[model samples]
Target: MISSDFDSDGFVDIAGLDSTGRYLLVYFGKGANQFHGLTRYWLITKSDKIYSADLFKKFIPNLISLNKLSGKIEIYSFVNRKLNRNLDISVGYYPENLMFDDFTNSRTKEIICYGKNFGGISLITFQNEDYKIQKIDSENTYANVTPIFLNSDEYLDLAGISLKDQELHIFTNRNLRFSKSTIKKFTDRIAHLASSDFNDDNFKDICLISNSTNELIILYGNGLGGFPTAASFDLQYNADEIIIQDFTKDNLTDILFLDNASKNIFIKILKENHEWNSSIPLTKFNNLISFCLYRTRSQIGILCSEAFERNIFSIVNSSLALEKNIFTLSSNPTSIEVLKNTDEVINEICWIDKLDNNFCILKRNEFNTPERIYRFKLLRQFDSYVINKTLENQLDIVFFSLGKNYFDFVNFNLSDQSISRKTLTIYGAIDKILFFPTDHDTPNVAALNQRGNSNYITVTNPFKINPIIIDEPLVSSSVSNYFFDSVERILFYMQPHQVDTIIEFKSKKFNPTYSQGETKNHFRAEIKKGSQVITHAMDLGDTKKFDILNFFSSKGDGYLLTSFYQTDGYLPDSKEDEIILHDKSKIKAVKNDFSKTNEFYIYNENSQSVESLLSLKKGKRILTKKIKEDKEIREFTINLLPRERRELIYLRNNSPFIYLENF
Candidate 1:
C-alpha cells in the first residue's frame, strides 16, 4: 500500500492494490479518520507489486506497479476520477523487489531492482521519453538491497545481505558506479537491513535484524566505507522488517521493527550515549499485515494495516498504547498517504479523489462535537497571490493575479466579516507587483510590464480611483525603468542597457551633530533622461584605485575625497615628519576608516579645462572646501604626517599651481 496527497490538497489519500481482482483501489482521505471516493481501476493482477512515486515531480504521486507476468513497469496517475496508465517500460525480467531513489540527484527517482534470477541488481532511469537500464553486481545474489551513503562523499551506495555467503555487501558509489566492499562472518542469518546516522554524526550507520538468533546487530560506520565496530542486542521476538528513523524527534535515529510471530510493532529508542533502549511495544492491534510511519505537519503517528481496517496511533506518554482511531476499509489497501497537512493550526482539512473535482471538507479534533461536512465543487485556483497590511487602518489587502493582464484586489475586514474585491486590467502582462511604502495613507505600487517581446515599467498608486499608469516602454526608447521618489517628487529613470552612468543626489537629514541642525546624505542612482552628463579623466601617480574612495560635489565643483596611507619605514625623532622607505617596499595602512575623509582634491574637470597637473607634497595631506558660495579661492585643511607617496592630480588648465598659506 502507498499513501500520497493525490489531489495536491495537502490531506493524505490511500491507493491500495487489489491484486486478486486486478484492480487498484483508491480512497481519498478527508481527515484523520474520514475518507470518501472509494474508486477502483483495472491495472495488474496479484503477482504485481505496487509502489507510489512522484516520478514526474508534479506534486501528485503516481501508482507504479511491477508486473511479473508481463515483466514491465506500469505507472498509473489519478486524474479526473480515473486512474490512467501514463508510462509503461519493459524490464525483460522481473525482480523480487524495487527501490525508488534519486541516485542521480535529478529530482526524479530511478528504479533499483534486486533479487533477480540472474543473481544481480538492475537500475532503471527515465529521462524524457527515453529510459536507460544498467546491471550491477551480476555475480552475487542479494536477498534485499537498500540505498545507503557509506562514505563522506554524498552519493547513494548499495547495502545488501547475502544469505549464501553469510556476509553483508557494501557497494560504495564513486562517480555513479558501485564497487562491492564485503563484511564477512555474520554467524546468524540477516533478515532485514536499515541505515541511518544514529549517533548524530554525518556517517551512515547500519542496523540489521537476525531472524535465526533473534538478535539485532548495530554496525557503526567510520565514514570511510567501513563498518569496523559492531554491537548486538538480544531481541524478545523475531523481527522480519526494520525501519530506521528519528521517530522521537530528538535528531538521533531510532529503530522500529515488526515482530513476525505476534505481528506487533516495537521501537528501540536511541539514547545520547550512543546506546539503544529496551524494545517498547508500539502497536495496539493484532494480526497486522504491515505498518508505516504516519506523519502530518502537526503530528506523527504509527499506522498499522490489517485485513479490514487501518489504525493510526500517536505517542501519548511515550507509548502507542492509547490508540487514536481506526479507519475501516471495504477492501485491503496497497498504498495510502497517511497525512500531509502543512498548516500549523489546522481548522479544517479538504480533499478530492480526482484533480479539479468536487472535494469534501471535514472539521478536525472535535470527535464528540457535531460538525457540518461540506461538499463543494472545485473552483479555479489563483495563479499567484500576496497579502500585506498596506493601508492606514491596518486591514490586509490581498493581491491575486487572475491572469497575465488582470489582477483582483481583495480587502478583508475582520471586524465586519466582509470582503471587497476589485479587478484591474493592466496595460501589459504583469511580471511582478512591487509595493513601496509611502508616508501617505495609501501604499504605492510599481508593476513591471512586458508587452509582446519588449519590457516596460508601469508606476502608479493602485489604491486611488481611476489610477494613472505612467507606462515607459524600453525599446529604442530613452527610458528603461523608472522609480518615483514620492517625498522629493522626482522621477529617476535609466536608459536601455545602461549600467555605468550614475547620478548622485543628497537629501538633508536632521542631525544635531553637524554645524547646522542637519546633515546631507548622498544617495546615488542611474542618471535619468534630460539630465546633464559630465566627463572627466585623471591619473593619480603611484596611487592605487582603492586609495581614492568617495566623490561629492557642492555647487557644480567636484571634490575627490580619500584617506591618507602610512609608509613602511623607520622615522627619526629629529625629523619625525619624514620617513625613508625602500624602493620596492609595500605601503602599510595606518587604519582603514572607510568614512575618514582626511584628504580632498578640487578636480572639477567639467567646470574648468582638462589635462592640467598638480603634485602632492610629502608627509602632508590636503583637504579643499569652498568657504563661501561666491568665493573662488578654496579653503584648505592640512595635516602633516609621514606618508611615502607623490601623486600628480590632474587640473583643468595647464598652469603652475602653488599653495599660498600652508607652504
Candidate 2:
C-alpha cells in the first residue's frame, strides 16, 4: 500500500517495499533543485529471525542515470517477483496525478501507467521481464484517477474524467482505445464510479457521483457493455463523493455521500424493491473531506472526519435515523475495517487516527452501540496504510509506511488484546502497500515507493512469530436481582463455570434502569469461577445494541438454572456460596430439546429466559432432567461442566464445540 503523509512535519512523502523484503522510504525535496531527488533509500531485512534496518548507501548511485527531463517528473514503480527485477518509470510535466494497473499472465507481466500533466492522461506500459517501455496513448484534456482493473485478461480498462470537457472516457486494453460512444458527458466532474449489484440481478452496476452535483446517478446494466440507462435523484444534501454498499442487510444497495464544502454526511437507504426509500442527514461537522463504510451482522458503521477530527457513528433499526453516536475523537481517520467472528460481539472496528498519531479500536455490539476500546501510539506518523485479519482469528496485521525511510509492520491480537511492532527500511519513498499470499503457506508484503531519482521496490516477509493462543477464560459473577414495578420484570446475573458471565433481565419497560426498581432483591452467594481475560467491557445499557436477556442465555444453561434471579429484592455484595430462593412456584419448568438436530425451547410464565435460551445452539432440555430424591439438581449441572478451564463443548452429540468462554 502507498500512502502520503500530507500532514507530516518533515519532508517525507511516500514509503514502500524493496525486492528483498525490505522497506523503502522516500522524502521530497523542499525547493526546485535538480539534485532534489530521492534523499535516501533505506533497506530493511531479516537476519537471525529479527528484522534489521539500514540506509541503502549504494542505491543512491541509480540517480546518476535519471539526469534531466523536459517536464516536471512523476515516477511510479512495481516489482515483478517472477522476473526478479524492478522497473522504474516516470511521467513528465504534469505529474501530480498517477494511476497503476497490473496485468499478469502466464508468460508476460505488464503494468499500465497513466497520469495527468499539463496534457491529458499519459498512458505507458512497462514490460517486466524485458524491462521494455512503450508509450501507447495520451490525451491533452483528460485527467485520470487510479485505474481499477475489472477482470483477469491481457487487456486492462481505465476510466478518466476530462478536467477540461467534463466527459467520462473508458480506455480499453493496454492498446488505449477510448470508447468514444460510451463516453458520457456530465454536468459536473465525476468523482468516482463504484460497482455494486443495485438491482440484485447478480450483475454489478456502476454508481457514479459528481463533485459538483447533489444528485447521485446509477447506471443499471453490467460493465460488460458499459452502463445501460442512467437514473439520477436529487439528494437531500450536496454530495462531493458517493459510496454504494449494503449497509442495512436488506441485500439492496445503499448510498453514503460526503459533502465537500460543509463536511456533513448523508445516507440513503435502498429498499428491497430497488428504490431509494429514505435520505437522511447522518452527521455534520466542519471541513469533512472523506468517509468510508463497514458492515457487521447487525449494524452499519461510518468512519468519517472533518479536516482535523475523525468521528464514527451507526444507524439504528436500519432506519436512517441517527440514534447513537459511537465514537467522537480528535484525529483524522484514514481507513477503517470490521474484524469478523473474532469475539462474542458482532465485530471490532479498527482505524488510524492521525491527530493522536496512533491506531484505535471501537468495539461494536450486535445492536449497533459502540465503545472506545484500545489505542496505541506510534513513534512516527504513518505515510500510508493497509490492514488484514488473518486466518483462525490469529492476528490483525497492519502494514503502514513511516517517515521517508521505513515501513512499520504491526500485529494486534483480537482475543487477547495485545500489540507488537516492527520497522523495515527500504530504497525509496513508500507510496503503496499490497500483500500477496503464496500457495506455499508463506506470504510476502509488497511496498511501492518513489525515489526522486528513480522508482524502487521492496518486499518483506511479514510473519515474524508463530500464532499465539490464549487458554484462559473470562468469568464474572453478580448478586443483585430485582424486577422493576413499572415494567413488571425481573433481572439477574449468571456466572457460568468457566465462561464469561452475563447480566440479564426481562422488562416491559422499553428502556430499563436501576431507578425503576420498586424493591431490593438479593442472592446469598455468587462465585466467579474463571479467569478475568477481557481488558475492556462495554455496557450497552437498554439501547438496542444489547439484548440483555437473550445475550445472557445464549451461552450455556438457561439463566434460571445457573443464575440468581429475584423479582422483589436486591442481594447484598457480602454473600457467597449459598442460594436463597423465594417464590420458587413462580418459576415454570418446560421441556425442550437441547439437540442440534431438534433445537427448540419454550418460555415459562412471565420469564424471558426462553428467548435467551433459544439464542444458544442447543435448547433448554438438558436443564429439565427429573430431580431424584438422592441426587440434587445443582450437583448434576455442575458435574456436566467441562473439566478444562477453557474447554469447548456441544449440547448435542457429534456436533463440534465452539469457544464458550471469552479469553
Candidate 3:
C-alpha cells in the first residue's frame, strides 16, 4: 500500500494494489482547496516501466452501490498496488479496511462494508473473473468495523454496538462454510487489534482497545480456531486508538494507546506471567489524528499526529527513556518506519507532509545523533510518496503526481529551540513524496510556478549536496606523561628514564646548588635538555678522597668507575675550574721515536701503561712484536700542574702492575 499527499493537501490518502499490480484508491482529493468527498477512485497500472493510472469510469458507480446513500464509507485496500480489472468483482456493500488472507491454498481478500440493507456482515471472493458475496449469518445487526483475518481460515470482526459499545466476533471458514461466534463483548468501542506470541506459548495473542472504559483486553489462545481466554485492565485514560506489538524483547506483548480525553499517549507492557504491569505517558498533543508503532530489534517508533502537525519519537531500552522532540511537521504524517539491519545504527524515520501548495519531505537521521531532523518542500500534485532506505544509507524520496512538473525541494536545519520559517514560494501543487535508493546519486530539486491557465513558469534547478567537513588539530605530541612547575608552566614530551634520574638526584641531595638559587643553603636547578643535576650539596666532614673498589664485575672488556671527592676551600677560585683533584700530571710531547721502543715509564706509576703513555706523546707511533707472555708491556704517562696532577695508563694483556707511594 502507498499513501500520497495528493494535491499538496495536508492529509495523506492511501492506495492499494493487488498481486497482479493494479491500483485501487478511493476517496480521492483534487487539489489543496478541493476534497471530492469520500467518493472518488483511481486505477493505476504499470506500463513501459512506469506506474500510470487514469480515472476509472466505474469507481463512482461502484461506490454508490456499496454505501447507504445517506451514510458514507471510504474504501481502503490493504495491499500495495491497485486492483486488477480482470479480477475485480461486483460484490455487496462498500469495502472498508480490506486485507488479504493467504493462509490457505487460495488467496482470499476480506473486507468490511456496512449499509442499511447489508446490516450484519458480508465476505467476498474473486475467482475466474467472478465476484461472490457471503453474508455472515449473525443474530446481531450493527455497523461492523473491519474483520481481521488470522492465519487463513480464522478471522475476528469488531462490530460496533450502536456506534458506542464494541464486541469481538470470531469467524472460521471450514469446508467453504463460514461459522460465526461471539468471543468477547465489552461496553466500550474497539479501536485496533495486534496479534503476537505474548506468553511464549507459541499461540497468537490478541490485544485490542475497549474505549468505553478506556481498557485494554488481551486474549490468548493456541490458534485462531481454539477457545480464547481473555483478561481486561482499566487503562486509566480514554483510548481513542491503540496498537500492540513486541517492543521490549522480553518475548511478551506491549501496547501503545492514544488517550484523546487527556491528549496523551500511554505504553503498557505485558509481563511474562500474563499481567499488565506499568503504563508510561508518551506524549501530549491536541486533536490527535492517528498513530502507528513500527518495531525494530532495538527500538520502537511512535508516529502520531496533533492538530495537523505530526511527530515521531523513539523509545530506548537501556534506560527505558524516550527520546523527545525528534521531528515535527506542518502537514499530516502519512507513514513511519523503523528500519532493521541497515549499515547505520540509527533507524531512518520518513514522513510526508503538505506545505502551502506543495508537498514537504520529512526525514530523520539514523546514525550518530540519529535524532537530527530535516524537512523539505516539493512542488506539483502527487498521488503517493515512497521513502526507501538502501544498504548504503542513502535515502530516496519519490512522489507520484497526476502529471510531471518541476519541483523545488527546499530543506532546512533548525536549532533545538528555534522554529523554522518558510521562506520559499512554490507555484505548482504537489501530490505525493516518494523515497527510493539512488545508485550513488543525490536527488535534485526544481521550482515551477503557474504562468497562465495552462502554462507554468520554471526556475533554475538546484542540486542538494552533503554538508562540509571540519578539521581539528591535536593539542600536543606527547601521549603518556605530563608535568607542571610551581608557576604552572606545563611540560610535555618527557622520557621515562629522565623521570627516574630526576627523582633519584632530587632525593639524594637536600641542599643542592641551582642556577637560579637566591638562598645560602637552597639552590634552583632547571633541566632544559640531557639530564638532571644536584643544585646543592650538604657538607659531609672535611675534604676527603674516597676510592670505592669494584664490588661486582662483568667480562665485556668495558668497565665503569665512580669516584667521590669532598672539597672545603671556600668554593673554587673559578666556578668553571675543577673543584676536586686526586693526582696531577702535565702531558709533554715526545722528541724520540716512541713507536720502536717497547719499554716506556712514567713518574706516576699508578697510570703507567703502554696505551696511556704513548697517547700522551702527541703524534707518536707505537708498534709491538709477537709476544706470547700474558704480562708483557705496560706503559703510563704523567702530567704535573701547579694545582692539579693527571695520569694515563695503557696495558697489554695482564701486563706489569704498578703501585704508587704517598706523594
Candidate 4:
C-alpha cells in the first residue's frame, strides 16, 4: 500500500495493489477518518506480488508488478486514473522482494530484486532512453538485501543472505560495472536481514535471523568499518524476523524478534558485559512484523503491530528498570498530524575565543541630555579569567594557577571581595585550565599543566585533587571555528585557510558539558562547499564580553535573509528579530563599536520596524518632561539617542524600560 495527494487537492489518498484480486485500488480520503472507495483498475492477468515504491524518488507513488506464470516484471506510473506503463523486464526467477536505490552513485535508481531462480541478485536500470536488466556475477538466492555504505567511498554497497550458499555477503559496488562481494559464512539459513549502527560504534552492523536455527546473529562492527564475523545469541525457539533497537534505552542496540509459531514478541537486550538477556515477554493475538521505528514529537521509541490485533503498541523506555506504554494506535493507524519543524530559536551563540581582541562596551550618559547619543568603545582584554565564583566562604579553596618557574595560585574570597596570592613550584606558563567532575574529589579541581607554544602537554595531579595525566591539546590548532556533526562524525574547521587541513581531525565528543559556571559555548554559521554540508558551525569569540552580534558576510553578491540572536541569554521568538538589510548586496563589517550602541526602532510612534541610519539622523523629539518653577510648569523635550529611546528617565537607567506617565 502507498499514499499521496493523488489529485493534488492537498488531501492524502491511499492506493494499493490488490495482489489477490489483481486490481489497482484507490481510496480517496476526505480526512478525519473519512475515506471513500474511488476506483479500481485491473493490473495483471497472472500476478505473483505487486510492489509499490518511489522508484524514481519523485515522491510520487509508482508500482512494480511481477507475473507468477511468466516471471515478467512491469513498472507503471499512476496517471489518468490508471497505471501508465514505463518499463517492463522479465526476470527468470520470481522475485519476492525489491528495492529501488542507486548503488553505483549513477544518480539513476535501479530496481534490485531478490528471489527464487534469480541467481543471487538482479539490477534493472534505465539508460539510453531504454530499460536494461543486468546481473551481478554471482549464483545464489538472497532472502533480503540491504544497501549500506560500509566504506568511505561515495557509492553505496549491498549486504544480503545468500540462501543457496547459506552465507552473508557484503557487496562493495565498483562504479557501474561488477561489484566486489565478500561472502562471510556467519550463520545458517538466514531468513531476515537488517542493517544499522547496532552497537553505536559509529559504524553500521548487520543483523540476521536464522530460519533453520532460532538464532539472532549480530555482525558486530569495528570502529574502523568492517564486520568480520558474527555474534550469535539464542532467540525464541521459533523466532522468524528481527530488528535492532535501543528498546532498553541503554544507548546500546537491543534486539526485538517475532515468533513464527505463535503471535509472541521477544527482545534480547545487549548487556554492558557483552551478553544478551531476554527482555519482558509479550504475546499478541495475531501475527506481527518487526518494524516501525516511531517518533512522537522529539521523543523516540518503538511501534509494532500484529495482523489480526486491532491495536499498535507504542513502547517507550527511559532505562532498563522501567517502561511506559505511551500510546495505542487504532486498528490500522496510518499517519498522524506531525508538527512541522521550523528553525529552532537560536540558543547561546557565545564567542569562546581565548584571544581578547574585540570587546565592545557601551557607556551612556546618566544625565538628562536626551539629545546626546550613546557612545561605545572597544577594549582588548581577556574575559572570563575566573572559572567559578561563589558567595560562600568555604568555596574559597578553588584557586587558579599561573605557572611561572614556580606555581603561583590566586585564591579569592568572593564574598569579602579580596584575593591572596601564593607561589609554589611546577612547570612553565599555564594557558588553559578546566575544572571537570571527578569521583575522587569532593568538588572538582582545575586540571591543566603549563602549555606555552607546545602542541600537547600532560597535566598530572594539579594540587593533588583529581590526579591524572592527560596529554590533550590546549585548543584545536588556531581554530577560528570548528563545527562537528555528532551524527556523521564529520569535523569541519575554519582556520587561517593557510592551514589547508580542514577535514583531518576526528571529533572525539560533541558539546561536552563544562563544569558548573563554565561555558563550552559555540557559534553557528553556514559554510557550504559543493556537496559537502559544512553549514552548522560557529567558532568561539573573545570571552571578555557577554554579548555579540555575529554574522557571516556572504562571499556571494546578494542580500541574505538570516536569523538574528542576542548572545546574552534565551530570547523570544518574534518576526521583528530578523536580519534586516538595505538594497546593498554586500555586508560591511567595520571593527567599530557600532553594535555596542545598537538601537531599537520606536514601535508606536510609527509602524516602521527599524531605525536605519537615515531615520537616526532626522533627530525626532523622543523624551518629554514638564519642570515646575515659580508656580509655572514648562514642557521640556529632547531627541532619542541615534533614534533609540524616548524617555529620559529610562535612558538614564542605561537598561531598557518603559515610562508609564504618572502611573
Candidate 5:
C-alpha cells in the first residue's frame, strides 16, 4: 500500500494493489477525514510513486504506475477530479523503486528510479531546469539504495547495501559528479533499514534489521551528518519489518515490528528515555505488509494485509498493544519478497495468496474479506539448470541401475530442496564408471562406462544416447587413446611383474669418510613378485662427491692423481716445485709403501658380485669407493641421493705413478 493526495486534496489519500486481482485502487480522501475509492482493473506497478509533495523540479504533482501491459512506468498528474498523463519513467527490466529526493543535496528534488535486475541507479536530477538522467557506478547486483548525509556536511551521499556479500556501500557526493563508493562488509545480511532518533542526540540514526541474526543494529548519527561505528542490540524477536512510532507519547520513538515468531504483530513499548523494553504482546496474522492507523481521536489501530485478506487491530487502552481478531487471511501464503524502490516510499507488498489449484489476485470485498479477481498459475519448479564442472574438481555423478537397468542421473535442486530425475540409458550391469570433463563452454562430462562382461570402454552423455565404445587392453590402467590414458584397477588386474630396484646403501650414524664395515651387504630387502624373489644391487661409498687422491707408497715415494671437477685441497699450498713423486726413486718408494693400504674391498648385499672399494688415504681419512684400478673393472662404489662413480689405480714398477694427469 502507498499514500499520496491522489486528487490533489489537502488530506492524505491511500492506494493499494490487490496482488491476486492486479487492480489498482486509489482511496480519494473526502474532506472530513475520510476517503472514497476509485478502482482501475490493471496490474499494479512493481514500484509505485505519488508525488503528493512537489518532488520533481517541474512542480508537477504526479502519480507513478508501472504499466503491467508494457512493463513501463506511467506517471499521472491530478488535473480535474482524477489523474491524467504527466510523465513516464523507464529503466531496464524491474526497476525496484522510484523516489523524489535531493540526491545531490542541491535544494532541488529529482526523480530517481533504481534498477534491480539491470544493475544501476537512474538518477534523474536536473541540469539547467531540464531533466538529466545520470547513473552511478554499481555492481551487477545490489540490494537497496538510500540517500544519507554521512559526512560533516550538507551534501547528500548514497548508501547501497547488498545482501550478496553482506556489505554496506557508501557513495560519497562530489558536487556535479558521482564519486565511487566504499563497502563495509558485515557478518549478517541486512534486510531492511529504518531511520529514527533512537538516542537523545536528536539526529536521524539508521537502524538495519538483520535477516539472519534477528538483531537491530543502530548507527547513531552525529549532529554533523556523520555516524560512528554501529552498535547492535538483540530484538528478542525476529522481525522482517519495523516501523517507528511514538506509541507511548513519551517523545521516545517506539518500533512496531512484524515478528515471524507467531506470524504476528508485536508492539515494543519505549521508556521515557528512548530505550527498548522487553516483554511484548503476541498476536498472530500472516501479514505481508502493515500500516498503523488512528481509529478515533485517541485510539490507535493497525491496518495489515495478509495476502488474501486484511486485518485491523485496535490499540488497547494504556498498553498501546494491538488486539487480535479484527480480521484474518482467506488463504495460505507461500512467502514474501520485499523490493525497495523508493526513498521513504511504503508501497505494496506483492502477495502469493493461493497455493493450491487455480491461482487468482484478490482484495477486500464488501465484507472486508478478500475477493478473487482472476486466476492463473505461477511457476513452482526451477526449469533449467547448469552442470558446471572443472576437470580438476571432483563432483560425484553416480548412475544407479534401478533394479531393471532403468538409470537416472541425480537431479537435486538445493534452492527449493526438491529431488528430481533425468533419464540415463545404460544396460547390462556396468562394473566401472568414470566421469571426465571435455573442453566446452558449458560443463561437459565424458563417462567411461565399462561393462561387467566386456573388455571395452563406453562413454555416455545426453547427446550421444548410444555409448561410445573403445576396444583396448582391458588389463591396462586406462584405455590408450588421444584423451585420458591411466586407472589402478586395469593396471593391476591379476598381473604381477618384477621391478629391478637399485638400492644404494646409506650409513645410519657412521661417517661416510671413515666407516669400518662395507655397506654392500649392510642393508637389504627382498621383493616377492608372483613367487619370484627379485634380487637387488647395492653400491657402497664413503663420500658424497670424490675429489683429491694422495698415497705414500711402500717404497717411501708419493703417488697422486686428482679429480678434474675441483682443486686438490689436502696438498700444502705455494710450492709448485717440490721433492715429489716425479723422481724415479721416490715414485718407486711411495708406490711400494702404500700398495697394500691403497686397496679396499666390498661384498654385495646378496653375497654375490664382489665389488672392490677404492682406497685413497689422505692423512688419517680413508674414503671407501668401489672403483678398481684395472681398465676392464667396474666402478668401485657409488653415492646415494646424488650418486657419483669413482675408480682407483695401483702402480707397478713398470707403469707406475711417475706422472699421472687425470683420474
Candidate 6:
C-alpha cells in the first residue's frame, strides 16, 4: 500500500495493487474520513507490489509497480484519475522487495532491491531521462534488505540478513557502489533486522531477532562502519517481526516484536544501563502480516494489518489496548492506508484496495486504550524551563507562567514605620524569573516580562521596591536570550546593550547574614605635615590654612601619627602612610585606594557649612574608621577626588545606601 496527495488537494490519497496484481486501484481522498470510488487501471497481470514517489518534484505523486516474474518495472503517471505509462525498464534479477531512499544524498528517490535465489542487490536510478540499474554482486542471497546509515556519511549503506548462511552483512556505499564492510556470522538464524539510535549515542545501531534461539541480538554501531558493542536478550518466545522506536516517548528506544505462535505483540524498553526492562505482552493479534506505529492527538498507537481485518491498538500506560476495527475488508481485499503515521489523526488518509476492481476508504473516529497500562510520559510543559538552587537544598521553581497576565507583588516590612503589604494586581505578567544568589539576605533577581509581544528583561535592580526598567526590549521567545550555567555559577544570556556582548554573569555563594560588628579598640589618627606630629583641628573655612601646608620649607615627607588618649600609647617611630579605622558600621573605602586610583581627596561634609569642613589629599591608600552606630543599612562606598568639583549629596538617617563614585 502507498499513500500521497495525488491530486495536490492537501488530502492524502492511496493506491495499491489488487489481488490478481494486474489492476491498479486508486482512490481519491474526499477528507473527513471519506474517499472517492474505485479508479482502476489495467497493468501487467503478474505485478507484485505498488509504490508511489514524487518523481517530478511536483505536488502530484506518481506510481511505480514491480513485476518479479517478468523482471520488469513500470512507472505510471496518475493525472486526473488516469494512469499514463511514462517509462518501462527490464531489471534482470527477480527483486522481491523495493525500498525508496536517497542513497547518494541527491534529494532524488532511488529504488533499491535484493534479488531472490542468490541474485545480488540492484539500484535503479533515473538519469538522462532513462532508468539506470546498478547491480552489486553478493556471495550469499539476502532474505531481506534495507538501507541504513551505517556510518556518519552522506550516503546510505545497506544491511541485509542472509538466512541461508546465518549471517548479517553490511555493505558500505562508496561512489554509488556498495562494498561489503562487515559480515558477522550468527549462531542462530536471524528473522528480522531493524536499526535505530538505540543507545541515544547519535550513532545508528542494528537490532535483529534470532528465530531459532528466540534471542534479540543488538550490534551497537560506532558511527565509523563498525559495531564495537554487542548484546543479546532472550525473547522467551518465537519472535517473527521486530521494530525499534521510542514507543514510550521517554527518549529511549524500545524493542517490539510479534510472536510467531500467538501473533501477540511484546515490547521491552531499553534502560540507561543498556539493560532491558521487564517484557510486556499486548493483546493478541490474529494473522498479523505487518504492523506499524501511528500517533494520535493524545497518545501513540499501533496499526496492524492481518488477513481479513485492519486492527488499531492504542498504547496506554505501557499496554496496547485494541481499538474497534476501523475497516472490515472483503475476503480478498488489498487495502492500503497512509503508512506514515507521524502526523496527527485529522491528517491521516486511508484507502483499501478490494480485489474485484473495488476500493474503499476508512473513517477512523474512535480510539481506546488497552486493558494493560500504557503511558505517555510528559517530558516538558513550558516553552522552555530551567532549574536553579535558590536556597540551600530548596528549589524556587520558576517557569513561563503561561496564560497569566499578572503577578503578586510582596513587600516585607523591615521596621515599625513600614507595614508588610501584598499587592495582587500588577500589569505586564512575568514570563520568567532567574534568581542570582549574592552575599546578602536578598538575591539579585533577573526578571522577564512581555507587553504587546515585546519582551523585556531587567538585569539590574530586578524585583526591587521600584524595579529599574530597561528601555530596550529583549529577544522574543523564539530566540535564545540566555544560557545559565549552574555548575560554574555563570549566566550567559543575551545582552543587546553590551558593546562587546558581555553577557556573562559570574555569581558567588549566597550569604543571607548581615555584617557583624567587631570589638577592636578605636583610635584617632591625623595626617600631619613636614614630618612633625601636630594635630590641626578641622573647622569651617579652613581651606586657606590647609593649602599653605604644601609650602613646607623642606618639602618634607608627610606621615600619619596614631594617638590613644585613654591608654597613653603614641606612635613616635611609626612611619604608617595610611591610617585605617573601622567603626561599628561597614565602610568600604574612605580615601584613594586601588578601588579608586592614585592621588584622590576626601572631603568631610558638615550640614552647617556651604564648603567642605575638611578636605585632605591621600595618595594611593584606603582608610576605614570606626564610628560606632546602631542602624542596619546596606554597605556603600563613596568616591571623591581633588582639584575636581564635588557635588553635595544628602543621605537620610537609617536608610539603605546607594553606591556613588565620582571618576
Model 6 over residues 1-663: C-alpha lDDT tens digits? Answer: 555666767665656666688887766766532468768779954688777777656546778788887777787776666678888877766777777777776646788776555377778887667777887655667777767788767888889877567677888988687788546888767777878877778998888887788787889989988898899887788767666666655577887777868767777767767788656565466776546554333334454555566332323221122222221122122212221221222111222222233222222232212111111111233222223333332222222344454332222221222222222222455555555556655444455555675555443333466654332344333222333322233222322222332122111221122112112222332333322322221111212111111100112332232221212222233224333112212212122322232221222121111112122333312232322122322232232323352212222122111111122
Q: How high is the CA lDDT of each candidate model? A: 0.51, 0.40, 0.35, 0.44, 0.42, 0.48
User: Once all C-alphas are superposed, what RMSD does model 3 give against the true structure?
Assistant: 35.9
Worst lDDT run of 10 residues, candidate 3, spans 544-553
> What lDDT does model 2 reach?
0.40
Which 10 residues in a row give candidate 6 its minimum summed lDDT?
544-553
Per-residue CA lDDT of model 2 for 170-278, tens digit only, reads 6555444444333587877766666667788765566667656656777775546466677887665666666666654446777777765656666677655677754
lDDT of prediction 1? 0.51
Candidate 6 stretches with Cα past 4 Å from truth are 14-16, 25-41, 55-61, 271-274, 289-302, 308-663
TM-score of each: 0.47, 0.36, 0.37, 0.42, 0.42, 0.46
Off by over 4 Å in 1: 19-21, 31-33, 44-47, 116-118, 308-364, 368-663
Between candidates 1 and 6, the TM-score winner = 1
lDDT for model 5: 0.42
Worst 10 residues of 5 by lDDT: 653-662
Query: Which structure among the candidates has the greatest TM-score?
Result: 1
Worst 10-residue lDDT window for candidate 2 reads 650-659
**Could you give candidate 4's per-residue lDDT for residues 312-347 as a string of tens digits?**
344432001111122111111111111111121111
Write the residue-wise lDDT of candidate 3 on 1-663 in tens digits: 332433323433432332233334333433221234442334332211111111122222121112233223233231222332333334444333333332223544343444324456555554544555667643554543433344434434332333323556665656346566666666656655556666777665666665666677767766644545777787777756666665544456667677777887766766656777556564567776545553222234454434444332322211111223322222233323232323433333343443233333322332222233355455554444444443243444444443344332332323332222222234444322222122444432222222233222222212423311111111212222111121111111122233432211111111111112221111122222343221111221232211111100122222211111122111111111211112111111222222222222222222222221222122332222221122222222221211222222122222111211111
Clashing pairs in 4: 120-140, 351-541, 352-540, 352-541, 353-541, 383-544, 407-424, 523-538
Clashes of 1: 11
